[model samples]
Target: MAYAIIETGGKQLKVEPGRFYDVELLHEEEDAAISIDQVLLVSDGSTVTVGRPLVEGAVVEATVMQHRRDKKIIVYKMQPKKKTRKKQGHRQELTRLMINSISVGGKALATA
Candidate 1:
């Protein structure tokens, strides 16, 4: 098994091939290919490579599966003595990604 740790949208994720993740929304459309360059670490069965910031020539390839919003969250504000109250709901935009491959040292490995 192999895995890569990638940074995206101010978050770190451990990615494996054929797995899907929900991340911050990007400008691209659905099914578009996405390349992420912020690779922090990669590991194979016998060896591991950790980058100072990010490994050179390391990239993660993924596909944008869909665009959607997360479940709604409610916000309420009230003043006990002023008869003031407010309510709101919010849903954050998100993008669904399917990890295709992760490459290190110009070589690709199977991730599971």
Candidate 2:
């Protein structure tokens, strides 16, 4: 099995080709291709490459699937005896991406 660890949207994600992942909102149109260069590590079952902060010449290709928001979360605050209550809800914007390939040194390692 081959996999790569990529950093995006201030978070690290373990990604594999052919899989879909939901990440923080990105400023790109749906169906657009994106290249992620902040690869921390890559493994191909037998060999592994690690980076100091980020790997050189390593990239992950992905396609923007969609843009959406997460489910609402409710926040409630109450002050007993004071008769004070506050309620709020929140939904986080997100984007869906489909992993297309993993490459290193301009050589493709895996493709979906």
Candidate that would win on lDDT: 2
- What lDDT tens digits, residue by residue, belong to model 2 across residues 6-111? 9999999999999999999999999999999999999877999999988899999999999999999999999999999999999999999999999999999899
Please list the Cα RMSD from the true structure of every candidate, rounded to 1 decimal place: 1.5, 0.8
**Which predicted model would earn the best TM-score?**
2
Q: Which tens-of-lDDT digit does each residue in 1-112 have in candidate 1?
A: 7888999989999988899999988889888998899999988767888999998888888999999999999999999999999999999999999999888867886643
Q: Which ten residues in a row have the lowest lDDT in candidate 2?
A: 42-51
Q: Backbone clashes per model, in order? A: 0, 0
List TM-score per model, in order: 0.90, 0.96
Candidate 2 regions with alpha-carbon error over 4 angstroms? none
